[model samples]
Structures are given as structure tokens and as C-alpha cells.
Target: MKKNVLRLFVVGLIWLASCSPLTRVLKNPDINEKYQFALEFYENEDYYRAGLVFEDLLPNMAGKAEAENVQFYYSYCQYYQNQFDLAAYYFKQFYDTYRRSDFAEEALYMHAYSNYKATPDYNLDQSNTTKAIETMQDFMNRFPKSSYFEKAGSIINELRGLLEKKAYSIAKQYHRLRRYQAAVIACDNFQKDFPDSELKEEVSFIKMEAQYEYAKASIYTMKIERYEETMEYYYYLVDRYPNSEYMKMAESYFKNTQRELYDLNP
Candidate 1:
């Protein structure tokens, strides 16, 4: 049994070694041979090997007649194999190195999509989301006339919403822990950072609530002054988004703050 296992392993190694030399295959008039071999590997689901062969052909094929098709399918092989990061890198190279190619716009879009695929969950690292959004935005800016405009725009909106949600979560956590000063600052930053965000209503509500809580925790003599600041926030919320559900809540707090001032001074 052990001998049979060892024999099988040796046979596999020999097979791989024979295929390894295919990486050196480049464009001659013999491009057809390399293409045929790569197609066989690709159809057999041996994407890694197919990608290897394609990448090797790149430098030699550059400026040659077959460059465009080779680079396009190379990117596709990486993409189809779920190597999104590598696919994104190759797509970027294709876009930059072959700007005049018919595949340029499509390659650019795929570059952005690859990064978008790499984005982590909202609660995890958002670095990829940030990168994805920025890359998509840049792609849109560069290729506004490209067919990818609307798709890229939709991706930008989705990524922006995720980032806003992260900021709101951090601010809310601070508020929930009674870290009033920190919460106030964080909430303020969120409002400024995403002024036109979908989170405007929730942000305004949190800002008002945090201001009121901070006021409630003040010294007795400073309570009136603090309440005055708190009232300003509520009024701001009501004025800025009158139709918001949060406005009704803010109105209740505004009345409460006014009553507190009267009671304290009377």
C-alpha cells in the first residue's frame, strides 16, 4: 500500500514537472500552441496553471498582435478562479498597460469589482471597502463615458452607506456607555463627515440625545448652562429635519429643557 502511494505521488510530480515548462511558452507564430494548451488547462479547471502560462506570455506578447486577448483572458482566469485580489491587480495592469485596447473600460470595471469583492463586513476592517469605494469613484471619474458609470455609482452609494453605519455605531457605543463628551465629539464628526448621508436623521437624534445627557450629568450650578446647549441641539434637529420622526422626540426634549431652566431659576 505504501509503495503504491509513493508511486502515485511520483507520477503526479512527473506530470507537474512536464507541465511546468509550459510557463516558458511565449508568442511566436506558435501562439496558437500556447493558447490551445492553456484552453485545455482552463477547461479542466486548472486555473492556477492556466494563469501561470498566461502571465508568462505577457511580456513577450506585449506590442505583439495577441497581447490584448492574452491579457484579457489572463484576468478572467484569475477572476473565475476566485483570486479576486490577484484578479484586481491584473485588471489594473491591463487597464494601465493597454489603455487603447478595446477591453480597457471592461478591465477597469473589473478592477473595481475585484476590490469590491474583497471588502470586509461592516463590523470588521473597512479598509477594503474604503479602497473599493475610492477605486470605483476614480474609475467613474476617469471613464464617465464608459458603460460602467451607473454600476460604479451604485457601488459608491452602497460603500458610503456602510462607512456611515460604522461611524454611527461607534458614536452610539460611546453614548450608550455614558461617555458623553466623547460621544458628542464623535457624533459631531459623523454629521460633518457625511453631511448628505442617509443617516442624517439618526445622527441628529443621537446628537440631541447626547447633548441632553451630557447636560444632565453637569454640576448643579452649570446645569442651566448645559441645558441651554442641549436645547440648541434639539432646536437644530427640529429645524434641519422637521419631517423626521426624530423631530418629535427632539421637540419633547426642547420643552423639557425649557421647563428645567424655569424651575431652576424660579
Candidate 2:
């Protein structure tokens, strides 16, 4: 009974504090009073309320000595509150609204990172991932000399790898279905589109397998010719990956194809 009474008392005090005249004074029309209250809220880590107060003063304080700091802190407030979408929006706004502001570059980078932070799992829609990659690319193009350029480039590479993985996964699905022609074409397209991707080994392996499958599905009368073509693919793999386990498999396949050709022509 005592604990219940204590809880009730605490809840009532919180309600009264929210509705108090002091709350009004802090959020009132006086700029200095509002600014001071915003500072207090920010210091107390009440970011949502602090962001609200700072946003209210931001436009009016533009060109004032405190504008940049206010906007910067306001953006951070949103970030700390886990309001990443709002943080991204405000950070981009700050980047666009301020020229020659000290935090401009950081704001731009954080705008991209904010979107990246909101990226979902790879199985989900990649809309935000694509947006983050584009934004980071834009940042790099705009500020080639900025110290953040390398970091941004690295992020782009990581995002691109995610896209590459998606493509590889879909292509492998086609392979598993015995859609050899489609799988071959998809892997070829992927290599053409993303030549610098880290999935090069996987793509090459898939391509060789797809070609071999196509060859294997041929009629016995045509098998010799088709196997010869498959041998060419295997040879390519051997040349590219001398030490790969796939290379050993390819060499075995090539020798089998050569002996079959000899037997068929004999």
C-alpha cells in the first residue's frame, strides 16, 4: 500500500510539473527565456524537447552568432533521441541553409550517416541504402578535398557490396533451378555491371558451373561439341584461379571432355 501511494504521488508531481507555469515560462515568447530553457533541456539530455525548442528559434536566429551552434546542437538532439529520419532531414537542411558555416561538412556527412543508420536488413527494401550511397557519392563529388571523402568512399563501397550480394543471390537462385542459360547470362551481366565487386570469385565460379550444366544437358550426339565448349570455360577458370579448388574441378572436367572427344571421333 505504501509503494502504490508513493508511485501515485510521483506521477501526480510529474503531471503538475508538465502543466506548471514554469513550463510555460520556458517555452514562452521571450527569446532569451526560451533559449535558456532549451540549454537546460539539452544539458539534461531531454533531446526531444530541446530539439523542439531549438528548432523554434533556429529560423529566427539565422545570421545571429548563435545560429550555427543552435542548429548543430539541434541536429545532435534529434540524433541522440534516435529520431534518425528527423535528424537526417534537419542535418541536410542545415547543410543547405548555411553557407560557410563551420559545421557544414560534418552536417553533410551526418546526413548520409543518418540515412545509413536507418538502413534495414539486407532482406528488406534497400531504398534507404540506395539513398545513403547516392548522398555519400554526392558529398564526395562536392568535396573531393574534404577529409571525409575517403570515409564516404568506403561507405559507398560497402553499400555497393550489399547490392552485389543481392545480385549474386538471385543469380544463384536461377542456377539452383537449372536455369543454366539465365544464370550464365545473369552472372555475365553482373560482372559487366560490377566488375570491381568483391564477389568476383563467386561470379566466376557460378559462370563456369552454369556453362558446364548447359553442356551436360546436351544430347549424346551433340555432347562432344558442347563438352568442348564447356572445356573452354573450365580452361578460363584454370587460367584465372590456378590454386582454386574450382580450378582442380575444372581441370578434371577438361580432361574428361578431351577423352570423350577422342573416343567419339575414334
Candidate 3:
């Protein structure tokens, strides 16, 4: 108990020592002094207090040369605090207001990167993901020789992969729910949208299976056409991936579909 009490006392004293400077600066009448202390806090990685000090200095520093630095560092404060949406907003604001400033290029990149960090998982809404891609693309177009160009390309590819995974999941979900017609349509759309996806084999199999199931449930007049569509998908799958892991199930569906077509034509 004595040791624990001593440790707590030491921690409390350190906390007070740290807080005193910020408290004194906030009360100081000299704006320059406060600005210097804010930069000190920011350099020391004390973003929360630095943000407070910077926020206080912004209105007074307007039209002064210090305003630009204050705005740039304030956006970084939000970013380091993981307030990504707010970071994106402030970073964009900084770049727009200081287009010719030395930090403008970095600020614009951070704006798009903040949106990328704000994007949700593959299953959630992806509006921000799309926005991040567009903003990053704009950055690349504006600064083709930037050091951030390669990194921006990588981010776009990763986000596109997320979108592809989401699309594939939705198509699979439709198939799982026995919405075979919708599943076939969704699978076709996914194929068209992501022609080079690694999931193409599985998607092709699912499309074929879904079409076969739909044909099985259709009326006599529609069964032949639907089954013929299934055969086309199966052939495409086999032609592209003859050694696919899904070939066994795909062949079973193909054989069953062919039997049906034969029965209908006979």
C-alpha cells in the first residue's frame, strides 16, 4: 500500500507539471508566446493540448503568416487523434485555402488518405470508399510526379479489391437465399465489373448453378431456354478453368442440365 501510494503521488505530480505550462499559456496575453507554446506541444506529440492552443490562436493569427501553419497542424491534430472524417474535412479545407502554400500537396494527399482510413468494412456502405478513390485519383492527376503517386495507386487498388469482395459477397448471398434469378444477374454483373477478379472461377460456378436451379423451377416453356443459358455458362467456366476445384459440382450441374434439355426436346 505504501509503494502504490508513492507511485500515485509521483504520477500526479508529473501530470500537474505537464498541465501547468498549457494552463499558463492559455492565460497568457501575448499571442506569440501562446503560438510558440502550441508549436512546442505539437512537436512533443501532445496533440490534444496542442490542438486546444492552436484552436485558441487561429482567430487571432488570421492574416498573419502563422495562420497557414496553424491550419496545417490543426488538421494533423485531428488526424493523430483518429478523428478521420473531421481530419478529411480540415485537410481538404487547408489545401483549398492554401493552394500555393508549401504544404498544400501533402494536405491534399492527407485529405484523401483520411477518407480512406474512414472507409468501413467490405459489408458496409462504401460511399466514403468511392470518395477516397476519386480524391486520390484527383491528387494523382494534379501531381503526377509526386512522391505520393505510387502510394496513391496502391490505395486505389486496395479499395477496388474491397468493392469487388463486397460485390462477390452480395452475389453469393443472393444465391444462398435461393433467389436464383437475381443471383444469376448479380453474378453476371460482377463478372462484367471485375473481369480479372481472382473469384471469377467461383463466380462462374455460382452463376451456372444459379441458372440451373432457376431452370429447374421454371415452366416447361421456359426451362429449355434457361437450361441452355446454364450450359453456356458451364462451357465458359470449363474453357477458362478446366482444372477448377469447382469442376466436379459444375459437371454434375451440366450433366443434369443436359438431361433436362434432352427430356424437353424429346
Give all TM-scores, in the order shown.
0.76, 0.71, 0.85
Pick out the ten consecutive residues of candidate 2 with the lowest summed lDDT: 20-29
Q: Which model, 1 or 2, shows the larger TM-score?
A: 1
State the lDDT of candidate 2 residue by residue for 114-136, as single tens digits: 88788776666778889989988
Winning model by lDDT: 3
Per-residue C-alpha lDDT of model 3 across residues 1-266, encoded as one tens digit per residue: 99999999999998898689778899889999898999999999999999999989988987899999998999999999999999999999999999999999999999999999999999999899899999999999999999999999999999999999989999999999999999999999999989999999999999999999999999989999999999999999999999999999999999999899989998
Q: Lowest-scoring 10 consecutive residues by lDDT in candidate 1?
A: 20-29
What is candidate 2's CA lDDT for residue 31?
A: 79
TM-score of predicted model 2? Answer: 0.71
For model 3, the superposed segments whose C-alpha errors exceed 4 Å read 1-24, 219-221
Question: Higher lDDT: candidate 2 or 3?
Answer: 3
True-structure RMSD, every candidate: 4.2, 5.2, 5.0
As for candidate 2, its clashing pairs are none
Alpha-carbon runs more than 4 Å astray in model 1: 1-32, 43-46, 59-63, 218-226, 242-252, 255-266
The global C-alpha lDDT for each of the candidates, from Candidate 1 onward, is 0.84, 0.82, 0.94
